[model samples]
Target: MTDQAHSLSLPRWKEPSILPGFGVGVGLTLTYLGLIVVLPLAALAIRPWELGLSGVWHELAAPRVTAALKLSFGLSALAALLNAPLGLLIAWTLVRYQFPGRRILDALVDLPFALPTAVAGIALSAIYAPNGPLGSIAAKVGIKTAYSPLGIFIALVFIGLPFVVRSLQPVMQDLDAEVEEAAQTLGATTLQRVIRVVLPALAPALISGVSLAFARAVGEYGSVVFIAGNLPMKTEIAPLLIVIKLEQYDYAGAAAVGLAMVAISFTALVAINAVQTWFAGRGRA
Candidate 1:
């Protein structure tokens, strides 16, 4: 009895599984994550260490670098903010209301994920170009959507939309409509039901989707460039600036900028995760 208890309490190197090759599965998981994710980030941090504090600071503080970083982080947040509510609405509609071509609409939500970034960029540029239909309308309003900061914002929103939609879909699907009916039966108005019940239930998933979208938008490159016009200190984004540094043979500078990117992304993710945690706890409470 003592020996059996000890064996049961031992750490699992390979978890008991119904599936075959648990050891190989674990090995492949670790190997893929280490190579594709951990190794690159580790190098990103280590490479810039050769540049001491002052050297890294100098690279990061360059006017163009600062501007690019500002634009990249700011626009990403804005795009993510725009996506959250819109995604929620779409997810709610898809799950709640049966409409014509519902399956097609559901499939289209993942279009950004499936589309190549460069191709998406070109297509967006064409749609918002001066001669394009929407561009003509915007031009009349003294607003330029392409070849400007607005264009970058648009591209980020386009690419980040899918993240928000997909993250909330599973959660929305699992939500019970009977709960809403219960609320209504208890003298809850439509607004009250949504605010007091639906919103709280959806809060955790909403935060998750928004955070994922923001992180993705921050790292976006190919889709933003064609639309941004790559104007230094004007419309350039940080990832593009990093590429410019590499092209200029300023490897240390590139790494420094990359380091800043990593730090910013890490900080945002942490803060968002904290918010998610709070919301999750609140929902439970």
Candidate 2:
């Protein structure tokens, strides 16, 4: 019996049961989340219930509302797509190259996160305004950057760059360079090696980054307003429209729009997550 008891596995260092402690921690966490996240979202959703079906439909289907939705979502998607390639290129250089000012450039990628959105908007507006250096050159060609959809896209791109870069950086660091070297040794061309070997490993991170960036840009308000010109049915965005509705004392209308945006953004995020799952499954398979 003694030998059998000794042979049996023993639980590691059980001083006391931690159930009480764990339960308290979990309770606090849930309470905090409820107050901060769930409460605000629930309030937004509940406010729309006061609006009847026709009233809700009228608010949502208004031309200006539709225009704002389209512009915000469309520009956000474009910015994320544009950033994906540019971010990958930047990440590749930061990881693979050892050039002058490389460290400084890498540090600069995170500037948006630290910088206030309002400051970023002001700076971008000044740089791309008609009289500004690049804008002046473009003006000669009859192109305007500020106070347009183009400006909105640029702002989104500015804010979203860090997401793509940070997401891809660690993945790039972990990626084995030997795989590429082997592909090269086997007579793979530059593009062929990159397409076959380099991209597969980075694809998951890239997708995640793109999705995150798109989500962020979709909700971006501060940096876009100044540059977007906020014209109804033109440069107006969903967030601004919601704010406008609130200013008009149309709480239900504002909540309705906010709810719609939340729904759409949530759906997009879900789809992206499904894609990520499929990719993960494929990797395992």
The top-ranked prediction according to TM-score is: 1
Residue 14 Cα positional deviation in candidate 2, in Å, after optimal superposition = 17
Q: TM-scores of all models?
A: 0.92, 0.90
What does each candidate score in C-alpha RMSD? 2.2, 4.0
> How many residue pairs collide in each prediction?
0, 0
Which parts of model 1 are misplaced by more than 4 Å? 1-28
lDDT, each prediction: 0.91, 0.91
- As a whole number from 0 to 100, the lDDT of residue 264 in candidate 1 is 89
- Model 2 segments beyond 4 Å from truth? 1-22
TM-score of 2: 0.90
